[model samples]
Target: MAITGTSSFSVNSSPVFRRDVTSASGNLKRNLDLKRFAVSSEQATTSSTTTKKFVENGRMWKKSGEESETARRVNVEESERNGKSLKDYFDEAKDLIRSDAAPPRWFSPLESGSHTRDSPLLLFLPGIDGVGLGLTTQHQRLGQIFEIWCLHIPVEDRTSFADLVKLVERTVRLENHRLPNRPIYLVGESLGACIALAVAAHVPDVDLVLILANPATSFSKSQLQPLIPILKLLPDQIPFSLPYILRLLEGDPLRMAADNLVKGLAPEPTFGKLSHDLLTMSSYLSVVADILPKETFLWKLELFRLASAYANSRLHAVKAETLILSSGRDQLLPSQEEGEKLRLALPKCQTRRFDDSGHFLFLEDGVDLVTVIKGAGFYRRGKYIDYVSDYMPPTPSEFKKIHESNRLIYLATGPVLLSTLEDGKIVRGLAGIPSEGPVLFVSYHMLLGLELYPLVTQFMIESNILLRGIAHPMAFKRLKDGKLPELSTFDTFRMMGAVPVSAANFYKLLSSKSHVLLYPGGMREVLHRKGEEYKLFWPEQSEFVRMAARFGAKIIPFGAVGEDDIAELVFDYNDQMKIPYFKSIIEEATNGVINVRTDASGEVANQQMHWPYFVPKVPGRFYYHFGKPIETEGRKHELRDREKSHELYLQVKSEVEKSLAYLKKKRERDPYRKMLPRLVYQATNGFTSEVPTFEP
Candidate 1:
């Protein structure tokens, strides 16, 4: 019978084979060939020449001088006993098949020089014609790495559907009995795949069930329509049609086996077997030049039924590990969507499809088959991604990869100048700030304390900088009412590595990575009793002298200029008369008064603690400048040579004054400038100017 189609190539038509004009065998080889079936003469000769490949009989016939006759006989007897045991096992296997208790017997490759067992037992179930010589030498070679078991079902030309199912059940039971404790896997092709699935359902021991080119539905009355016209014709008209049907009967040893034949076809070149099977319901198997889906209404109907059945069946919920390979180019069964639906139904199963391959994915992409099988235990497809859109846990490996790929970043709030620029474009010192030393943060304490939060959060979280602040004892201690203020929580400051140093421990803090953010002006600058605000108080000279001698670390004189202009203090401190006991305790703790003179020689000794002062400028803006670090490490402890340290400290203060002047000018041109017009009106309305004690 001749099958003329693009799928079947004529080797003789090529230049390499033009010179060979051969006989029937040669003609068959040249015109149509399963090329892998051809074996070399040398290999055939070598195989034929070998009677027993191993020295199995050597122990029975050993050297005479090596041992006594009785001992030699005992060893020979033991060897023969082992051989008999192997023969007995094979006999039992064959008997099991004859009695319909098991499928066909499979031979495992012996462990020898070339035959190494790497993979486990992989049982293959064939459709129709049980086992054929179509398998190539390469297939056998692969067996050296993995044990191959080919299953043969008990369905002949006349078997019914019920009988086929019984055969499958018996075969599964036999397999379980034979490999009682061992794990075995299944890979089924075409109708054979259907039988395997059935067997797998009955056998809980089966590790995996691989279905290849399986139909979407059973090929019974409706799908057999394509063969109807040809069946009406006699054997002489199309002799091969009846034989093909007989072959399909062999496939029916299990339910739905015959159905696999109808759904396997797809138009893609790689899926040629399936495509060819659908086109010609004749003896020949080859691709048709043109395909017409309209000609096979029965095939389509059967497929739709099969797909629906599989979807509705309990088999979809089978616990056996499954991997479904869909054909992207499948012309049969609406491959992509069907595969997707199947995957969704079987959420735990893995699904993969090839755009280049079709229904016969195993044949065209067998190399990938090895990989998929090896990875089956770990494979999980259609995994949900948790991206605020879904509920899935983030993978640790993915998190690590993202973390490694991201660059380290540091962000600071309020672009402030650290040093003057050569071109006069303020060189922002955020990135350039030295991370290693003791940094005393001297800044203006803005009213309402709103500016400090961003500064603190950014310093600790965004920038790698530790902070220490010399807060007032009043700020750190719990309120007299037994409740802690929100800002005074130790937990908040501890997370940021902030240490609130008392006046006694101020030196330790200033010596560490202690960035002491302090406002020397304190409450004196903050108080704008009746008519004064936005002005710096006449700072006590002792406040500057005491801070300098306390730490050998650099004194970073800084300021925060804007805030007081927002609200003027309209009331006096006496308005909220303190409880006498609380007032007495505070006064006792602070020494003579709440605020007292630190030095008698300094100009600030003349300033009274209750006096208040105010700024004459418009209440529009304020600024703070961070002067260079003052080197107080070399200074002595004596109050006599405090003159030199005082002179250097005054330089830092002058630099701060210069920065404040620059900021005032900057405020004039700055687009973000705003004024609290109400504070301006109150300041103009003769608000009182009074001072309260601030013990920072």
Candidate 2:
């Protein structure tokens, strides 16, 4: 077929293809042309290659081919001697393919350069497309650590969903037999994900861990079900066009075409020239075009049927531990609901939602998916481990580095004044903090959360305790491009033993008897707008109070003030929202991930609001005060009562507010609070300036 600028597949020729292609814009047609050109070029190169033939010992021999008949007979004898028959070799090949008549194929590893016997077997099942080539990016990265096996179903294999399940079962059984002791991970994306879950359910004895990405189990019930009738009407020999299908799939066509064009011209495309999504989609389309034939009507129908057939009933039989990676922006299925349903049905299940991704989340966000997989302990050595004890405590070297950074910050931002209650009286310099126990420091997050450096480092210096900070979920999440933002605070947060804020993580930390830091105000307090400094945007519910009571933990309410002095807010929420692009970006970032600020007047209305614009001012001193530890040891019974628990929650909020008010009032008394005075004192006394403290 000639590569054409416009897709030759007539919209009216096949009703199914027509309905599907109705969404395809002119951009999609151009993309298809590019893909076809690439394929045609590859075919041309292959066809041009000549095979050398020669006669060796009265037998025909090819220079670029295998050994002669005598050599083959000797090899056969050697194989038979080793208890191997032709059927054994045939069966081995069949394991990778559907049948004996099928073309010979082998599982392609993620990495082709190296082979490690100890690597875990990761079987990847493709989505409805059945191309099995969309995960090239994943394969490239994961193959380095895993024995990646992507199943390539033949285009002509029109097996029913049940038979497909059997095929997967057989493959898994063979792999299990080959590596009896080693762990096997079955990874499925979209349609393949549903198949993987079904296979897991059928083969109860086969020890397998499932990693499902945007499973299509809910597709039949989703908004896409309306398209099934149209798909069924498609002709048997409907023309295949990658761009047309991608556009129908709601993928960005123009960008994909542009990216493919760049790749075709340049072996290595420059990063940042094209958006990551465009590049990923382009690569996916290229693979799909290469593997799938033009007439995909039957395959499409089969996929739809399979999606409809695999209901929640089958999911109940899945005994293996499953990790569902749901995409919030999934165009093909109801990923979030499907994931939740699957989680409920499975005995052991964990769900993670990628809010920024679509149906091709695995292809677009491969690195982040890998990180989550590793974190979940899905790909471990030998047997599967239930829990991943991967939390790294702050090392001595990290402590030293943090201490040095803290000192520098203190010098730059002015002396950090620390105060706490001692014997019902105000005391200075961190004397009130307890030396041990499950201490939970509930603090108001300062603007940009800069207070963390002084608070955590000073406590470490004084008490020799590394505080495990409960941070925002954003701190642990990778960006939309499957890579961590350069110079992001995430690295710092992780190195300092900061875990993403979750009830489970909190409980784990408390149960382990570790010092934990929590900010009930969360992102709202840190990214507060102008005139909102030191304001507590704490939630009304007192869930943490009950949790603290359960662990009998010491809850110390603390607060900090200095953000107003350091910088002036130039743009508030209203100002930022006025910019259409900025507002859209914010919406995109938080869409389906978390609820954004909705109320305008409520205390927690703007709690989800972030992105405050600020300009630096004269450097100012930071002040912190930790209230008397509220011992929940004997208050476990009171926590059971909602009223009492809420009262306790209010009390903590009040204490944090009180600490902020006290700091604001008393900071005026500090001699070093003003820059000129401290500068003169420093100039006169060098490093030995005796700054006067406030009197109680």
Candidate 3:
């Protein structure tokens, strides 16, 4: 027999069945007794027919005057048993019943200190369960910051995808009227994400921002599609219940519930140590099983049809600024692929892939998801402005902070001597370099880009200019299907005016007359294999040279030698690949993602490198040398010639090599070249360590 509510257990007699029934029944009875007694003391509140039905079903009805005496007796008994008040048990019981509801549509408004008529409204759309109960953790936390509203669709209601869209549109309009000037943010999870997209497309001039987590766009193509055919064959009213069949179809309901609970409670490092809540597990499984049998055949068919329709829906109408949180570990759908598809279709879209999170990303990583939302400029207060076009350059205060932090690294790594070449002669410090105009510093990347901290900071300090470094796309992109890497460095990179290496961004920076740093070697240089240190792995194309000539930008080729001083390469990519487990991990991490080593050719092809494998040794001094500037001014015509551009590229590459050679030779003659002398020198001098340099 199908379990409807708490009353269904009264009909079951099997021993195994009795245990489950008794657990839920006992809890309900204890709670009702406590609640009935409380009601006896207080005046009876007005009750609806639905409340009366629930009371009758739970067997909690009582006549008028007897409640007070019964309540007093129950209160005394409850106090003796647990020394807790009747109200505490009543609340717990209420929560249990609330959670046990089949296809729950209940909404308990969260109290928020910042909630006001003017606060930005956030409407949350839930997954296929339609329960809208999983995001309790998110609601409690985010509600304090933004006005939160969760959509609850009753299981009995037959709402089409189009109907759902209309509902969302109407809700957003109502909220807009309440706030008037504030923007609305539609947050969707799985199926809800698809609904939000459809709503955004249908509603014009709504000015909504979408935050979608593990959207169910690939539901039609997923493994769940096969089950639809089987569901169709089943009779509308079968002789026996289909809960066991549904459980098998669902695949390990207990495990699924346990996984979600564990992830929600103790994420990442504390992953599996916590014990599973058997009560919660029972409730979750029972709710799903109960809802499946009750849902009409037509409703089940419509659900599948709606999902299929949404999978193939046109997304071009979605013009709102959208932030997609695609979980890499999502098993229910191909979230990463779907996110990319959506990103391509939408005009303004940013997709972040969470490598470690599953389909229930909001439940597992709510805090990080909220952090990403705030970072996307969706939660700004007071004024409403278009943040997409607003370039976030570092303020003077930020610059000072970065400068001071880098200063410590500079002092620790010995003195950072800045020099430039003039007429093929080495000139110490910034005196030889030009003071103005758009100048691009094309530098050879050291291992892990360790030279960046010293190079960028020293240039800014001495020349009073910030070097806007062009970074690898991976640096800005989230880790694919893995735990979040350190975000502080990425944030710092952005604040210090770092942009992904793109021709469009490069042109924009040059047009603004800013000092830009370019590393043509890219990931090839950073993830270089053993014996590839200080080697240039530049691509054959001379596109940057042609672009630089168009803007009359000065190309300053620079190089540094210091990675070898700080660490030694004990293992390389070949060594990593030899181990089967390690190889699988590397492949998983880089699946469908492009890296320099993925399809390397020429000098880079010979390296066959992966991520850098190094063992730290005693730290030694770092050396940097800048080559004479190659003026691209009035050389646009020369750069336009493919042969001339190739020649110019060769000249820049040669100059960078010269700087590397100069530093390598000069560093050998320096007194602080070895770590021992540098440490001794620092100890003797207390705060400062002087290094003797040789003339080049």
Candidate 4:
């Protein structure tokens, strides 16, 4: 269980870790070799047909052509379509059983899809296991974001910790020199995480982003005091049982395998295949003794002790932006506590807690490192975050997870979707809605923006349209001290295609022929007082009409009602202002963000942060109405007059009000508008079945 191999002890001054590697890399050079695969993205991603090889076990691991790579991917995909399950992971590691001897080297995993040329270089520092394939299942996905290099410290390789640091630092320095604009990523697990921190401490100036999973930097010898002796006393026959013991430390294999099936029930054949795979994978687990023998186990334990101390000392000098992934159920170390300490010690740090996950997070079933990175807003091609370009859309799996998580909201509030046709006939479903081009949907902000998820999620599900919401500027605001606002909470907005409200962003989105969702009422509408539900607090100006005309976009006025039915705003901004403590915190948070409404006039211009508390009512149905699309296509030139454009703006506003009026009146006629009837209907049908609303 000792995660000790990759941890390096380094002082403030970067320790020199150079050694003559000519003998070790001779076999690599003699075979077909060119630039040791790719050090970073630009160099690594070349013509698709060309072979990319890296040295593994004194052999050139090569993929000759596209056909072979495609076939390999097909087989891999068929075996584990969702992701590499626990069984597949064990099967992949079976090769380590032979106990072959070799030196530490880099391996570039094969990635089928095309990736950007400017992708960052991601070097994975191994845990105590030393077999760098810990990211085995994640390689294909990570390959799209990074030109991956796995540091494999051979089982019997006697390389010192300092020397290993030197070797990695050497590669880092060389890559940074070649692609000065690109940032390098260091992904480490446990002992590997400590090594990554050591590198960051030594090379503080390099543009490095560290993703550490259960770093052992906060280790205490007392924690391992009980297990050390028992590990050393293992007799020769014990190696056969090593896999059983290690699997206990690793995680529950059956539970891990079952995680892959969480989406739904599988066919009998699938379960039968899973059972067969489990038996096959068990034989691979027996290779654990070969990978980490009793002698090695005892050595790693002592090494882990030293690794912990040195890594602790080096934390002060680390300047890289760090993301610590801590597991709540980690049996090996107090990773959750270590993550907190690291967050406080490091200059810029963020921690993500996987409460249900094990110590080996990357190997776990539910964990997707790439999705985690996106959600954290840590994935970047260069130095600064270009909120628009660097934005990664939700993967199919991510979208599914998001939808299923919010299934309750769907069940509680049976949404009534109605759209206007060309003839002005309102109909159910979005059949009347246009699918083409630069479309702008002007909307009202439901209570605390409760209508957002249903609106956006439905658009994505029903029409395959991603409504890039024009989010309030506060969501993208930075702190006064110059540190970025916390990533964990706000970055999800970015991941879901929410751009900070700006004229420039609007223009860009329109120019790209995208569907832009805008809420003119902004903060004032969402945070309005108790009785102000469904009221438009929009500023009186031609803000977006002219811009929509410039792009000849279709402006659709949409309204959502039923916030009052779902929750009652028991406490609002007026109520909070009566209390000094809540009032001051609200003012401070609001003042920290840049002032956007300084020159604007009216009640809507009083833009401020308001944390309104709500008390849930019996769930009621939500009703949505999309009015007839107003075309600005050929009117671009005619609407140039200030009076003409302003007039058009008022027309759009009236339509939004009309839609609101339509939904409010119609929702009352629905039979299952209240919670009791809806629940009864769902009980008869299915929890996820769409409950009927009022006839359009």
**Cα-based TM-score, every candidate:** 0.31, 0.46, 0.49, 0.81
**In model 4, which residue pairs have backbone atoms overlapping below 3 Å?**
none
Please give, for residues 1-696, the per-residue lDDT of candidate 3 as tens digits: 221123332212211111111133122122332311111111122211111100111011223322221111111111122222212222322333342423222232322222333446677786755545445444434543466656555446566777677667776766566456677888888778888888888775777888988777777666556665666676765522244423322233445556666678445333332223233333455444444443543364456457547645758778887888887666667888988888777776877777656665665522344446544434443334321122333334445666676775676566456556566677657676666758888978988888888776666566666677787655555434332243334655665557766677788777766677888888778777799899998988774898889889999888888888788998877688899977776676565243534455776544332465689877777887877789999999978999999999999999999888878887777777766776776688864435555665
lDDT for each candidate structure: 0.38, 0.60, 0.59, 0.71
lDDT order, best first, reads 4, 2, 3, 1
User: lDDT tens string, model 1, 1-696?
Assistant: 111122221232221111111222212123333321222334334432332211111111223222221121112222222221212222322332233322233322221012222233455544333331112222333342244544433212233333444454554455455444434555554444455545555565444444444334233323444655654453433344333332332222122223334556333542454434333333222111011012222232333344335434645545565556555543333445655554555433445555444433443413234334322222111121111111111112222332233312101112233443333334444443435455565655554343454455444433435444444443333222221232223323332333333454555444333455665555444433454333444453435544655555566655555544334443333432255754454334334232333444333333222222233333333334455555556554652365755665566566556656656555555443433332343367643311111111
Q: Which pairs clash in the backbone of model 2?
A: 110-139
In the range 307-335, model 4's lDDT, one tens digit per residue, is 77878988889999899999876766788
lDDT for residue 674 in candidate 4, whole number 0-100: 94
lDDT of 2 by residue, 288-383 (tens): 453445445446655756655773558768888788888776766778888888776777776777665567665452234444664443555466
Pick the winner on TM-score between candidates 2 and 4.
Answer: 4
Say which prediction, candidate 3 or candidate 4, comes out ahead on TM-score.
Answer: 4
Name the regions of candidate 4 deviating beyond 4 angstroms: 1-82, 94-100, 111-114, 225-282, 473-492, 591-602, 634-642, 682-690
